[model samples]
Target: MVPDDLLLETRDLTKDFGGFLAVKHVDLRVRRGAIHALIGPNGAGKTTVFNLLTRFLSPTSGSIWFEGRDITRARPAQVARQGVVRSFQISAVFPSLTALENIRVALQRARGGTFRFWRSDRVLEGLDGRALSLLADVGLEDQRDVAAVELPYGQKRALELATTLALEPSLLLLDEPTQGMGHEDVGRVAELIRRAAAGRTVLMVEHNLPVVAGLCDTITVLQRGSILAEGSYAEVSRDPRVLEAYIGAQA
Candidate 1:
């Protein structure tokens, strides 16, 4: 049984593709309501780990447990329904849709109302009030009517996060939540991520060390598909193995 204090745990997680082991025997534990970060050099299998956790890709070996339930074989949709929702590396917003509409769509998907296509727009109007509230929570209320494609890149990501929040996930997985943004946008999104993590467990694979240090309570460093070090930012930053790995990856 999963401990009451733990929200997500993985045991000996491994993944292989045609004799190429991408992730190797990863044992991870995330505390309830804590913000944890997975950091590694390039090709360290961060993305593979995320895919495994979300059930987007099945593991070649190992077990995944959430809230004391074994979910290693759970389908992607089933895992999502269990409150483990992930935001994509790329924005998931509908470019053509207005920001409010995009959030409404996510709210509808969470409520299992997507099949009601025959319902008039008036029916969807009921979602507008709730959607607006969500947008306000993300500081996107003024841009609610703006086309997602036309919004600045940072705001686009905010909309995507708002949509993900619509699912009311207990465990949220973020993959590079602050990639490809100007310094200002990075700070903004970092704040947004911090706000989103309230009362929820967040496990993120992030490349920006400064952001990770600023926001994550704990950090796990992976080197060549295996954990090299796990600790707070100050602890891992001074580790020789982590320093060597980062240097080698850059070299």
Candidate 2:
């Protein structure tokens, strides 16, 4: 079992791509059952860090520990099986599939049943109840039969989230969960994430400051691939270096 004290931790995490240091020495700590936000301006390497953590990119150096075990060398599938899952910036919904079918695929994956993909989808009837419940959890019950591509942009994002939750992840890494959402959709997705986080840990990279302030218990601000500040929203917002970084980024 992962230690209750720290569900995920990084030690001097760094990543370089052909001499271009995308992520510098970074130490991240996420507590069990907490919502943590990693915020920074563009080019600060937030996504690069996510890639390293998920094993999408091999780190030039450093280590990642999940559930108190070193996962720096683990494959993406291996890390996912260890209960760390991530949602992409673009919704991972299948455009041609119905929302329910999309969620069923995730359920099948969580059960390591992907090998059965060659079989008829009717083979997945046993997962319907759980898929329906997940749909309801994300307020997509009414649209369960709708094609993912036909749903509104916001609902598509909701569907993506439901699929991720299907994995029963211990640590859910959301890369910009509210990216490109309008005001109403942003509020809705924020609430959805809030509700989904119960009994699990969430570490997200979000640019929506209000959403971060309202939902996250801890915030780590990255600048130029290094931590600029670490604190609550109020505390980080007040930091001069963070203010300068944002200002400089915008300029």
Clashing pairs in 2: none
Q: Which stretches of candidate 2 lie over 4 Å from their true place?
A: 1-4, 117-120
Q: Can you write out model 2's per-residue Cα lDDT over 1-251, one digit (the tens) per residue? A: 34568999999999888888888999999999989999999999999989899999999889999987999999999998889999988887899999999998879876666776478867789999999999999999999899999999899999999999998999999999999999999999999999999999999999998899999999999988998999988888888898889746766
Task: Report the C-alpha lDDT of model 1 over 95-152, residue by residue, as the tens digit.
Answer: 9999999998878876666777688777788788889999998889999999999998
Computed on alpha carbons, the lDDT of every model, listed in order, comes to 0.90, 0.91
Q: Where's the lowest-lDDT run of ten residues in candidate 2?
A: 109-118
TM-score each candidate: 0.95, 0.94
Give, for candidate 1, the lowest lDDT window spanning 10 residues: 108-117
lDDT for model 2 comes to: 0.91
lDDT of 2 at 119: 83
